[model samples]
Target: MMRIVTAGYSRHTRSYYSNQAHGLKYFLVRLQTEGFCQALVNGTLYTIRPGDLLLCKPGDSYELMVQLGSNEPPSGDYFLSVELNEWMLEWWEDYKQEVKLNVGVDEMLISIWRHLVYEKRRVKDSNPDIMDYLCRSILLHMNRLISGGVSSNPYERSVSNQIKMFIEKNATEPITLRDVSTAVGLSVSRASQLFKEAFNQSVMDYAIEVRLSIAKERILIGGSTLQEVSFLCGFANYTHFNRSFRLRYGMSPSEYRRQVRPQ
Candidate 1:
């Protein structure tokens, strides 16, 4: 399961830094809105300017040395930070090692960051609802930034991910590829293509796999009849469930349950 931790925005600046560094305990991401910050990332000096973003991992040593412009105020720089979940940390580590952000800054993401920070500032004392919305917006923006040139692939993966989440949430209800596709704004054919590309199976095939797995678990518990387990796992009727069970397991659901469960 994935989880999201603390998320917020802040704008601050420092000047003429003495040589100092903190033992990084969280992923540090800074979107520079104005001015610049000289950072020592992995012992390399990177001069980050406006519209630039810096990505840092936990325990990575870095120091910030901001250079204020002559026209810029004494404290003109701004940044935002969010502590990452463990899964997020693992994803970042993989990204840093593989994906190169060596290209010039992306203006679109910077604009998104600016809008998010402004939105965050607007409802400081009240509006928890708006804050929650802003967090989701930020997440989507970051995902777009990281997705790179794979236009249709991300859409495919997103659809599949949404379907899996929905299936897990509504395991006891009947579901179909058409249902999942409509839920994520795609046609059944497109959803099937995407799901096959990502998961190596058709949507209905995957759904049946999930259903049968759930049915097997229920049967082993010995509380429900085979028909009842089939219904609970979202099969339409007893014969259909029995046919699927025989095709997959080479035996009826009852026989499999009897073989697995102690007398």
Candidate 2:
């Protein structure tokens, strides 16, 4: 089981300082969504900007400062602290989690973080199961963002990243290959080949992956039926969504919901 101790968005207009000299008690993940701030990460002070991520483990020294300069914008970030269970411990050890990373400001990533914050605000009504899954989703998504740039050529990497960003933002719409290629100023064949080489998957295949991920989040949040979720997530119909969901998750959406939700 996963446990998220705290999750929220913070916006600081005035200066703010948080010094944790005694070390952190839980895993801390913070993403600078807007403005800028300085943080002492791993004994080095760094200027954190939009799209910068900070990952800190327990017993790590962490400090954050927001000192606004003349006409400087206020600092804002989405932050969460997690109490690692056995599974999370394993996942953490599997990757060499860096203190800071330049993961771009991805809309889908922000959406997931927003959902986690909203669910946390539910307090007594909040479902721990939902929080658990959302936190896991966020960590996994961050990992993917960190490792997605597989190309060594700087131009190829930039183009591939642009294609991914386009797909992420438009996956909920009825987007096509041509749209993706056009967004990145590449032809269909060139964009397709670039994305496949960079991510080891076809463009349409990656689109389905994004769709199913959105559907899963909606399904877990409830209120909407399976068919509605399918359409809302850009699936052609329930049948296709159901088949894809099963193929990826090994169970139908309903079964997944039942298993993960509180009875």
TM-score per model over all chains: 0.52, 0.66
Please tell me which predicted candidate would have the highest lDDT against the true structure. Answer: 2
Residue-wise lDDT of candidate 1 within 133-206, one digit each (tens)? 55455546665545533334434444556665556556668877778878768888886776677667667777
- lDDT per residue (tens digit) for residues 1-263 in model 2: 78888999999998999999679999888999889998886688888988888878888888999998778888999999989678778767755456777776777788999999999999579999999899989989877776786876545765787788888888989999999999888899999999999999999899999999999899888999888999999999999999999999999988998987868
lDDT of each: 0.63, 0.87
- Looking at model 2, residue 86 earns an lDDT score of 85
Best candidate (score: TM-score): 2
Clash numbers, per candidate: 0, 0
Question: How many clashes in candidate 1?
Answer: 0
